[model samples]
Structure formats: structure tokens, C-alpha cells
Target: MNDPQFNPETDLNFDPDGVPTEPAPAPEPTPPLPEAPHPVATGRVNTGRFEPVRQLYQRICSEVSKVYVGQEELVLSTLVALFSGGHVLIESVPGLGKTLFVRTLGKTLGTKFGRIQFTADLMPSDITGAPIFNMKTQEFTFRPGPVFTQILLADEINRSPAKTHAALLEIMQERRVTVERTTHQLEPPFLVMATQNPIESEGTYNLPEAQLDRFMFKVMVEYPTAMEEVRVLKEHSGQVAVEQRLEDEVATVTGPEQIMKAIQLCSQVLVADELFDYINNIVRQTRSWPQFHIGASPRAGIALVQGARTLAAFNGRDYAIPDDVGEIVLPALRHRVVLTAEAEVEGHQVDEALRNMIRTVEVPRM
Candidate 1:
């Protein structure tokens, strides 16, 4: 080998001269971390297949807010039930916009709206039409009742007797009416929103367990905040009536077909195997929880799953998250479970007990 060159300016490739330092190996590149799905409200998650659902939700809320000043959760619960193809039983004082909300919902949905003011005298035949003998035809003709509408408001439902209440059980569950052994099927996207007063017990009958079970959610309406009440006053102080305002301000966003399509999307929302366990765990936990005497039936679990799916879609997700289930569990199981006399005596509300029980259930990462 030749003598090593040591000149300052000499190329380093020669002997003794740095042989390029073996081309100093580059440090191994770090692999990228997998991306996580963020909270849906943050606008980080891709809307993907459920974008329409989210958009529809926003539009309806926007239009509804113009007239109905507050009670956001009430609106959301109704929407959840609506998308899940289930009924809602609301408990609120009068003049809190329950009727106004339902009317606005029916307007935005572009569906027919009907209201039945339940009284002690209200009969089954009054809600479900009975066959009337026609003199012209010389035969009986079946006349459909208010129940035939796509969106029905059963106002003050508890005022009606059990027999009248029984009429709704079949209509709610089957979306049809059977009169004279002839079945008349209701159109698609039928929604029944029944409201009862918690303050009135003298004239109100307690809802049967079976009837209560039919409702996917039992929403309790709270008084609006000061700002909300001010807005309500400002909006309603005008000479225009609520119906006039709803007609002038609220715009129709969709029809029954679109609503049915959204319902289908909610039905297709992805649920992990673990999520099934999580929901089962929650529902089953309610059965044995020390606070509850009567737990939710299997229908409650079904309602939870369906409600969660609809909520997930509302958040612009095609797949449900545990948080979605958490938000939905309250309304889904609150009415289904019964607190024990001890717990009730302890001044415990069924809602509070349900939330506490849910915290004990393990959440799935999915």
C-alpha cells in the first residue's frame, strides 16, 4: 500500500485518509404511529357513510331552534328515537314546548302530524277507527283514525284509561291497526311521541310496564336557562301564534323516504363483538344492581343498541363508540328499571342510579 496522504485538502477516500468513514450508516427510520379516531364532535373523524345523517341532524336542529327555544336533550332524544324507529315517552310540565317540538319535528321531517288529547273518556275506537255502517253503500266502511298519521302526538297519555292505552301498544309495536279482524298497515316512518305530566296523578293512570317498555326513551324536560327563556320570550312575544311561527319559520328538511333511509343507515352501524358484551354487561348489571328492584327487559337492551347506533350516526360515525353508548344508556334504561323502595326512600332517582351502575361496566376500546 502507498504511504497514507495527510494533506489537509486531500480527498478522504484513500488509505489512512478517511475511507468515507464507511459511509456512516443512516439511523434507522422510525415507523409512523397508527392514527386514532378522535371524538366525533371535534370534527376530526371522517363523516364517511354517515355524513348525510350528521347533516340532516344539523339542519333539523337549526330549523327547530328557530321556534323551540331550548331543551336540547329533549330534541336529541326524540331524534334518536326517530332514527331508531322507536317511540318516545316524555315527562314535562305544560308549556315547555313538548307540543311545539313535536310539531316542529313533524314539519322538518315533512311528515303528517296528528295529536290526540287523551282524556278519561277517550276510547280505543276514538284512537283506532271503528267500522261504521254506511247507508249509501249498505255496508260497513273502515275509517282510519288519527293513529294513521306518520307522526302522532299522544298528549297527556296517562289521562286515558288502560283500554285506550292498550290501543297504542299494538299501533306502536306493529305500526298498524286491526279493526273488525281486518288489518290496515300504517305507512313507513311512523313515529308516536306520547307526553305525560309528572305533576298530575289524580286523573293520570300509571303507565303499564309493557307499555313503558315499548318506548325507546323516556325524556324528562327541564326548564330552560335564563338566556333560553329570554329567547323564548323574545320569539313568542309577537302576535303570531306558535303554529303560525312554525309555519313561517321552520322549513322542511326531508320526507318519510329520507327518514327511512337514515333509519336504515343507523341499523347498519358497525358494532364490535366486545361492544355487544359491553351493552349486555350494562343491561345485565341493571338486573342485579342493589339499587334496582325491577331491571330492564331484553327490549331495553335492544333499545340501547339501537339508540347508540343512531347516536353514533348523529355524531357523523358509521361505527359506534363506547362513548356513544354512554350518552345513550341513560335515556334507554332510565324508564325500564325500577328503583327499590329502599333506594327510592333514600331519595335516589333511577337516572342517577343508572349512571352510577354504568360507570362500573368495562368499556370497550373499539
Candidate 2:
């Protein structure tokens, strides 16, 4: 009623006593968007990219042969487990190059490697990091252990007590260690290659079935052939001579980033739905079978698939075939399944059961 025509912009004014109000500052100018990450370009030819992975494998084998003489199968299986992002359990007698193979592989790949010589009195905190008091910050800081590396060689893993073995299960499964109410994530491409001496069981504690199941492959390294043994002797004639020989011959074949890229490519390998169903059927049969006291866990199924993918890549293929699944059957499932008392008494091996299961399962036609 005071003003019939309202013109707020022009008529409204601040009195001397009235509160002064400033016009809202112009909205800040919007910033430019960040550029997208560069995309890797594919070539015109689809000449299998897995060729690089195969080359890397061959390089690893060659490097390992520099230190280890025989057990080509063991080396290949260990590489397959690594490609699958899984750990391995090498069960063999002493002086079988199990430790050397792991160490050499670490050298060839140019990855951070650590070895933990397990003893009967080893503690859990010895493997997983432990918290320590810090005087500077007046707080406890986690001191990482040997497990925080690209490749961890658990030498004589069975010599450790059950509790020590159990400590690694969580690290292998979750890829993290919890200390002082804080969890530390392990670096990518983390792998644990654990070796156990089969002949010396006097003081060693048998790895619990639960701990055994964490390993993707249980490789049995046997004595080399006469020819391979000859090669070993020729290569290691004398400590000084062998040291001189490897001075300039060895070189890093691949980096951690390339290895990770190859692993990601393995995930892209095609697996038909029928093949998946076949795998499921085989896993289900293990559960229903009467010969087994405990069937393979879900982890076994995953291991089977991952192992097959790596095998396919090893064969320079971009797709998984039935033969791939059949090839890795024993190593992936042997440690996971437990036999019944009768099966054990009858000397029925898990490998034999796995072979039978593979034969019973139908192969999906491409």
C-alpha cells in the first residue's frame, strides 16, 4: 500500500541506519573437465596377444633353468598359478630347487621378493606385520614383515607350527594384513610360493586341511631324470664358476606392470556357458560322491576356472577349451578335497579320483 508501483531494483535503497546488504558475488566460473586417460590402441592384426605371455613364460623357464635343472612341469605349473593370481604349495624333498625356482622367478620378473625360513617357533606376527611403539609420534606404527612383497618364498612352510601356517591363510585369501585395528593392502601381483619337505616329517607339523585349501596348486616335485641331473651337475660344477657364468647372461624379462596386464588379458579369455555348466557339474559331483570325506570348496571351482584360463593363454589362445580344464584338474582340486578313511586305506589317490571325474564329465563341443 506504501508504493502502488513496485520497482525493487531501482526504488529500493539502504538507509544510513539500515543494515547494508551487498549483491551476491557472481557465481565462480566453472573449471574445465579433466582429460580422460589414454586408451591403448589395438592393432589391425589379431595375432594373439597371448604370444607375449607365452614369451614371458618361456623367459621365466629359461631363467629358472639357469638355477634349477629339471622339473619343467613344476616350473610351468608354478607360472600358471602366478598368472592366475594364486599361491602355490610345492611338496617335495629337500634340495629339489623349490626355493631356487621361486627366487629365480622373482629375479626374472624384477619383482620385490622376500623369503621367510619357517621354524617350529615362528610366530604369527613374524609373517604378518606387527605394531610397534613410536617415540617420535607417540603412537604405535605397524612394522611390515616379509609377507609385504611381490613374491614371498615361504621356505620349509611345514616346519612352522599350525598357528603360523594359519596366519598366512588370511593374507593369501584377503591380500591384506590386519594389525593394530588397521588393515594394510598388499601390493598387486602378490604371490606366495611355499615349499614343504616331504621326507622330513619327524618335527614338522602337518598343514591343517583349512590352510592347505588356500593354495591353488599343490605341485609334487620329483627327482629329475638322469639327463637333467647331468645338466644340473654341469651347470653347478663349482660355486665360483657358476657365479661367473651368470654374471652377464641373465636379465629381467618382464616387469610387474606387464605381468599384471597379461593377467588382466587372461580374464578376457572366452569360456562358453556350456563349459561353465560342465565345470559346475564336476564340482557338484565331488560333493555328492561317497569316496570323499569333504568336497572341494567354492575356491576350488574358482581355481579350476583361473587355471584353465592360464592354460589357454599358455597355449596362445584367447579362449578356454575343455582340454584346458581337464589339464589343470589334479593340481587345482587335489589339496582341496579330502578322501574318506576307506579310500585312504585302499590307497585311492585324489589324482585318480580327479581323473575319473574328468572322464565322467562331458566335454562341451565348441
Candidate with the greatest lDDT versus the true structure: 1
Model 2, span 1-366: residue lDDT tens: 012222223221223332113221222233322221111222122234554454556656776676767787688778888899998998888877665666677777878888999998999999897989999999988899989998988999989888898889889999998887789999979988888887788889989988888899998888889998888777766666433444455556677776776677677666668768878888888887778888988888888888888877666556676778877788888888889999999999888877886677777655
Segments in model 2 whose C-alpha atoms lie over 4 Å from true places? 1-47, 134-139, 241-247
lDDT of each: 0.80, 0.74
Model 1: lDDT to the true structure: 0.80
* Best of the candidates, TM-score: 1
TM-score for candidate 2: 0.82
lDDT digits (tens) for residues 1-366 of candidate 1: 111221112211212321222222222333321322554543344435564566677778888887888898888888998899999999989989777887888887888999999999999999999998999989999989989898889999999999998999999999999998999999989888899998979978888999999999998988899999999888888888777887888887777776776687678777767778999999999999999999989998898889888887776566776777877788888899999999988899988898899889988765
The TM-scores, one per candidate, come to: 0.87, 0.82
* lDDT value for model 2: 0.74
Model 2 backbone overlap count: 0
Clashes of each: 0, 0
lDDT of 1 at 356: 91
